[model samples]
Target: MKPRSRPTLARRLASGLATLVVLAGVAVANRPMVAVAGEALHTYQINRESYKKRYGHWARLPVPHDFRVNAIHAALLHTGKVLIIAGSGNNRDAFEEKSFRTVLFDPGTEEFTEVPTPTDVFCAGHTFLPNGNLLVAGGTKSYEVLEADVEHAAGVMKIKNESPDHGDRVFDKGTRLRSPAGLIYLTRTRVTVPAARKVTHGAHIMVHAGAAEVWVDAEQKGDGAVVQDPAQYTIDGLTGDDAKNLYGVADKITREKQEYGGDRTSYEFDPVAERYVRTGNMRDHRWYPTLIGLTNGEVLAVSGLDQFGRILPGRNERYLPGERRWVRAPELKRYFPTYPSLHMMADGQVFYSGSNAGYGSDTEGRTPGVWDVERNRFRAVPGLRDPRMTETSSSVLLAPAQDQKVMILGGGEIGESPVSTARTDIVDLDERQPRYRPGPDLPKPARYLSTVLLPDDTVFTTGGSSGYRGGAYRGEPRSDLFNSQIYRPAENAFATAADSTVGRNYHSEAILLPDGRVITLGGDPLYDETGKNAGTFEQRIEVFSPPYLFRGTRPTMAGGPTEISRDETASFATPDAARITSARLIRPSSVTHVTDTDQRSVAVDVVPAAGGVEITVPKRAGLVPSGWYMLFLIDDRGVPSVARWVRVR
Candidate 1:
């Protein structure tokens, strides 16, 4: 080839500049076009019947502007309506203004109704009762005050009354207490101290002092009034005899970061009345507690931060459904981290799967174990992979509760650490010496993953972040995952599902509805897409329809008794009776923070009758707790029918 003469510097510069300008123009023109084309292709692929048949489909529900509140908790009622509770929704301003919210959504009609929320039930624990009522107990009493924002030293003070003649004494808020050094502190809330009691013990009269605790803040600002040792203080306003009898005691007071306080108020949501009914207060204030309904029709409340922002130190209580009251259960004392994933096993023991949402010491109360309530004993299970990363993880009672298998999924390091793991492990509680075994790893490291069990004996998991509160990870600005999968226990594998349109992380929940669909809501990310500004709580809701829904027409069940006792057989009319292979009674989900002890599936033995099918309820009350359940019949093809409301007595 003929060698061209080298261009002059000016000529080369002009040519290079011209080429640069042309390339820049092309780049700018293709950016928007490429995004549009890619989105179009994704939409086409996901909408295709073949794709939807293999995987599932996700769609966003239209929520009215006024009805849209931050969904901090969700439960599916027996009436097929959803109860969504926000209760300030982690908004400090809203909590201060008392702008709590609760709404009811009817999935059948897609209608919304606002309900009056009496208190801040945010971060509270809830479970379904035998009568189909939801027992909601303990919530946010006070928001956290970071060390940088704390203005004064504070501590809990116990007031004692030693005079048997005096009646109960009520001290209003801001009551002052003076220490020996003349330092003063004010009570943060009103408190009532009972009168002293005289008891006869072996022919002797013993007078016992009555006491009550209240939070107190130093009267003076800064740390000058901080006390490091146990001390007694005199009541500010009292007579000569009263002053001696009524005294305050405290261990220590310091200018430290104040964690979120728990509330003692409790309520039972009456599904039929569509209102909240006040119940007796819990024995202990609790935030991030877990309330699991026991086989005896009572609820066991465990693991929460107290009103003074201290973990309750294993003290637990129980709710009496008959009297609508909570009583201290001193015999069943067991400690656990806040929001522990506790499930009641078939043998009536609670299995703690080592998954906790946060707010406890990393070294304490994080062991996977089986707790015997009657005997006050715990047996730890070994061989959990990445055990230190159990915070913000999820655990589920594998489908067909009879199998007694539990699986713990993805989690991150304690506190707000950015580290996460894709680890998954399973343990069979039925084994004599059950130990955790390795399972398939997740596609990526994740936290706050929502796992739901379906009637088809498969678990559907979706929506999590690879970082804390959906923050930045690796080189990405945000780590909210859209991918989903279906875990088949029979096959011991996972199949890919459709991606979610919205992100779900901390404070989010996924509930299995009566019609065999899962509705997912709520995500409180630490940062927005840019990872630079505070993220807004996600108010949008999404629904996922599994592949079974798109397979073919589902079996139909009709005309069943409203109540059936254990060991009793009930007949239900169904046109597809011959094709039905099995039946399941699935308890509805009342979930928050990815911890749901109420959701479980009990297999029912079914036999084809003359014109319908008869299902024999299991005789074991521990396997199937007394409560309302959605009865679903699954055909041979693995498709389940629309659930029929049934109550097991």
Candidate 2:
């Protein structure tokens, strides 16, 4: 019989605090409890009663440190994989120790695979590049002695029970993974591409519906004859159909006493004559901002820390490249706000939230509500179950239900400027207005965390420092914190999610894999699994995968995408089948969606084939709204045709 474990310190603390709060002399009417079903998922930072009592504290999986990590960032790739970007783990022997913590979790098999990142690298920020790959950038790593910083890839983190450098015999310096070295320290990663390729200027939070562009870094070129100098750059207006060319946006990095020498904006040159042509400029200057490609061939750059390292100011800014205009937005008011996350709903509204700085305060500073795009304004996000939370938490767009979407806030901390709040929360955006709901509480996440949307429609959260027992505040990576969990909000379930198969943190990135796996690239590189060390170190990239999963229609061998040749470095993340690789190409079928899950199947006739069959569009499924069709074609034997967006007349 499987043995049952007792509740953890974090969980008990949350429950105890929740129990003590009384409605006071006031009737419970004003603050109604957030009712939830047994199957509802509870977020780490927000949960049911998170508002009523400001309850739910650090409740991590009671599992032993045996590789269990604190909390980290998350990335969902096109391949359906969830990348767990961990911070501080049990690894050694690399230059970049801090950013080295990482893990990969495959939702397909619920397994966690540990892969070390390169040195001095922290995937603090990144985005999907053109050519469907990913562009990881901007972060740094260092040694435990608080020594000199480096620019190379930092290795995995090495977590010790009581680290010596941290003043405990349990862990000492000169630790390494396999080889002996010291611990690593990582900071935000800085790089540019894919994003730069799309807009010459920075446009935040909007998606470019049909623009095509390309991105190139300091690497050998394969297609464009025009050498794109390595400074920040982007190349817009690729030939032929606007949607056919992949556009990459540029990101910039600035550090004191350092001269990476670059303009806020630039473009790559493919001089091939048939390649992309540069055109238009974004109206404003945006650095390291969130850029979303709209279905209308436009990109919206969202709020970000400025080149001067300042957060949003009195007024936010929006850039519309199609109109080539910069519009000032509502003053960015917040107690302490981090970058607000952006997600375009099925109904066409771009939703965002302001987050807490994780300093630990309650009422004065809180979360920024939602913004209704059609009205082009901000709406107070009411009924937030947890009042302490600011929009800064990493909230993701889950599968839609009843025209309402459940916004799940994954593992991350809350609070104002000084104290951090360890809790969780979920908001149901089903009604015209946002309603607060509660789900399962988090298993780990004392420091803070991130979440990723899975291809299968589940949510995976991972990594964070600081726990209930409490040791260090910042710069503390642990073994007991070694873990990545999954919260199936729809099913109301919580399990030991080994999705990306590794623990990650600080500047980490997680991208979805086509075949339902997750690929986590660069971040504060850590050290060995057993708590070893590497001196003044850094690291290399590692791949994470789960057990018992298939490589469905891998994109790699797909005739190398009838795309341009410049992306020699570009490789498909999917496993390729020869028949499908050489299979015939089909044309687009005009179609649209009537609801979130309702079917609007399109067709593609195959050569010399009869007796048609059906293969549901796993990716495009549930991705449509009324008056919208996720239409695409597939040849015989279930090979997919190129996909495009079209309006049903």
Index of the highest-lDDT prediction: 1
lDDT of 1 by residue, 574-620 (tens): 99999999999999999999999999999999999977899999988
Q: All candidates' lDDT scores?
A: 0.93, 0.34
Per-model clash counts, in order, read 0, 219
Name the weakest run of 10 consecutive residues (lDDT summed) in model 1.
32-41
TM-score for each prediction? Answer: 0.93, 0.44
For candidate 1, the lDDT comes to 0.93
Q: What is the C-alpha RMSD of each candidate to the true structure, in Å?
A: 9.3, 21.6
User: TM-score: which candidate is best?
Assistant: 1
lDDT score for candidate 2 against the true structure: 0.34
* Candidate 1 local Cα displacement, residue 17, angstroms: 38
